[model samples]
Target: MNAQFFGGPYDGLSLATAEVNRYGRVVSKRFKGQRVHFVLLPPLADWERVRAGEVDSAPKHPYELVKTGDNVAFHDADVNERFNEILRAPEEA
Candidate 1:
């Protein structure tokens, strides 16, 4: 399972996937010569539904690399808004 980042320092980068069944596991690794601290978010409440292809799509981000006092912190991603944003249409200029 690969992870994708959006609208942050790691935007457009694909990183290794963490254990989807487990949450709050801090993992340290390097990307592009820079050290990064991050963790995988908890699986959705209805992950079974997702796996069954019931939802429109799976989460684009299953983890987050939040910044905390000069170091990266593992935390839950804002999945609700992200889903809405995905369903929303872009406004015309």
Candidate 2:
């Protein structure tokens, strides 16, 4: 799977490609050709904040693209059921 973050007046949009590897691993790769940019975080900072009761952000996986009237809302599910399914699938050898 390819995942990429797009920014501009339209930010926070991500593009991804999903594929199953010969070893049966579902892989996602960022669309590097799009040249999208994303914010980077310190690896351990999230864990520390979570333990400190300051991790109030939603999980960053399994997001849904919702369209309502003239507006679009991105919703992230608590658990990534779809992503899990892809990961668990057996790849073609």
Candidate 3:
């Protein structure tokens, strides 16, 4: 299957690609082909994956993408929390 880039609920955000590893790990997966981009997932997105057993990684791994952009790849503990602030509110609630 060809990977899809994520456009947030109202298209306020997007990702270059999503990669699911052979081990079942998932994130806003990146490839070298993408330039001047960012990979960020909703706070609930990773937790939902956890609930569904989609990711086989540690707790912080999901938000790893949010902590850094293309030029920097460092992990910051509060990345998820910070990202949640920018997500568009659901139209219904």
Q: Return the top candidate by TM-score.
A: 1
List candidate 2 segments past 4 Å from native: 1-60, 78-80, 86-93
Write candidate 1's Cα lDDT for 1-93 as tens digits. Answer: 445555433355444444333323444455445554545332445445654656533333434555546543333344445323422434322
The worst-scoring run of ten residues by lDDT in candidate 1 lies at 84-93
Give per-residue CA lDDT, model 3, range 17-90, as digits (tens).
33323322333322333312233333435645744667644533222332233432323224354333323323
Candidate 1 regions with alpha-carbon error over 4 angstroms: 1-23, 46-61, 68-93
**All candidates' TM-scores?**
0.29, 0.25, 0.22
Between prediction 1 and prediction 2, the one with superior TM-score is: 1
CA lDDT, every model vs. true structure? 0.43, 0.33, 0.33
User: Which residue pairs collide, candidate 3?
Assistant: none
- In terms of lDDT, the best-performing candidate is 1
| Cα RMSD for predicted model 1 | 12.2
lDDT (Cα, tens digit) per residue for candidate 2, span 23-77: 1122242232322111222223343464456664332334333445655343332
Model 1, residue 8: distance off in Å is: 14
| Predictions: Cα RMSD each | 12.2, 13.0, 12.7
Compared with the true structure, the alpha-carbon lDDT of candidate 2 equals 0.33
